[model samples]
Target: MRFMVMVKATGYFEAGIRAGKEHSAAKDAFLHDLQDAGVFQSAEELLPSSSGLRVVFPPGGGAPAMQAGPFLPEQEWIADYTVIDVDTEDEALKWVLRMPLPPGQGEHVIEVRRLASGTACALDARAQTMKADLQDQLSLLHP
Candidate 1:
């Protein structure tokens, strides 16, 4: 199974400066361990929304408006994320729970969600056969 683990930010724009060094070190170490485990496929720490772009449509059929910067509430910020492949959702959740948060922060919230399945790989029979073989291998390995 594959899961996307989201770490939500409580507040931001220099929030980390307030969190002490111990917190930073712990988080770094945990990330390192995750990578070392071979479970990590990809991971990235997000910049505060202030650095992004947002396009909003006008009330009518006029051209859509464009704007940038911190567009929403601070509570919506995501601290970081990791995409992991594991045996099951349960195992993925356990991995997410092990990640550490910055010091003085509230409980680090990690959202683990399963990746979608049952998508056709291609229109060709070879592709279909390959997908079936892969699925069968996974089932046998996990079971």
Candidate 2:
């Protein structure tokens, strides 16, 4: 199973100021361990939401409205994330629990969600059977 571990926090354009570069060593060590275990796929740090844009779609279908960040509700900010392939959710949680904390960061909120890899990856037998049936119907529609 592949899990996406996200680190969520509320901060401004200056999240790095208090986070401190000194913690990079600890972060690097954690990454090294993940790589050594052959579970790490990738990791990334997201920039402030102010650099993003939001598209709001109207009901029933119409032109969408575009709004630029910084968005409100600071609680929605996700600072960074990592993708890892593990045997089970418990194993993934074990790894996430060891993730190093950013300097000056108080409590961190992390979210772990399994990726929908493919028909054969994480889907149950029933889901796979349904997907196969759907594909058969779609093929007939085009042919």
Candidate 3:
């Protein structure tokens, strides 16, 4: 199973304050532990919302709309995420418990969610089409 562990954003993150050395070291150590355990797949911190964009689709089949960000409701914003492949949810939870808190925090939140895999859903057709299209594009670039 694959799980995504997301760190929620705060006003401090929006201000672009970097993580303190101690906090960074702690996080690095945690990541190293995950890698050593053979569960870590990927992890990264996101840029603030000011540098991101949101795409909104219309109710019908009209064109999609794009909005530049600085999106509010800090609780809804994501600061960073880690992806891990583990045997079960319990194992994933154990890994999350070891994650370090954000630097200089008042309160912070982390969310964990399981990801869908393989062709086990109603959207499998669409997903396969997109995958084939991507492969075709990549082949064109390489050839």
Candidate 4:
């Protein structure tokens, strides 16, 4: 099973306070361990929501509306994410429990969600094709 583990954002993170060396080291070590165990697939830390935007589709079917960010209610933002291939939800939970706490001494939340896999449905196939086309376009730009 594949799981997406998301580290929730806090007020401190929204303010752009980066992880301290100790916290970074701890996280690096933990990720290294997961990699060594062949469980880690990918991981990344996201920039604050201030650098992002939101596209909301209206129910009445006009056009998607864009909302610039510096979005409030910090709890709604995600700080980072990790993708891991694990045997079971219990295993994923165990790995999540092993993650280091965020720099400041306060409450933190991590969400783990299973990723869908196997044979693609019609919508999935369309999405996959779109993703491949986008990747090809990106390669042209970068390469």
Q: TM-score for every candidate vs. truth? A: 0.65, 0.75, 0.79, 0.80
How many clashes show up per model? Answer: 1, 0, 0, 0
The per-model lDDT (C-alpha) reads 0.72, 0.81, 0.87, 0.87
Q: What TM-score does candidate 1 reach? A: 0.65
Preferred candidate (lDDT higher): 2 or 4: 4
Stretches of model 3 off by over 4 angstroms after superposition: 119-143
Candidate 4, residues 1-143, lDDT tens digits: the string is: 98999998887888998768899999999999999999987889998899999998999899999988878773389999998989999999999999997656467989999988953242435678999999999999999
Residue by residue across 1-143, what tens digits does model 3's lDDT show? 98989998888888898778889999999999999998887889999999999998999789999999888763388999998989999999999888998756668888999988863343345677998999999999999
All-Cα superposition RMSD per candidate: 9.4, 8.9, 6.8, 7.3
lDDT score for residue 85 of model 3:
87
Kindly report which residue stretches of model 4 are placed more than 4 angstroms away from their true locations once superposed.
Answer: 103-105, 119-143
Between candidates 1 and 4, the one scoring higher on TM-score is: 4
lDDT for model 2, on a 0 to 1 scale? 0.81
lDDT of 4 at 95: 99
lDDT of 3: 0.87
> On a 0 to 100 scale, what is the lDDT of residue 10 in model 4?
83
Residue 5 in candidate 2, Cα distance off native in Å? 0.5
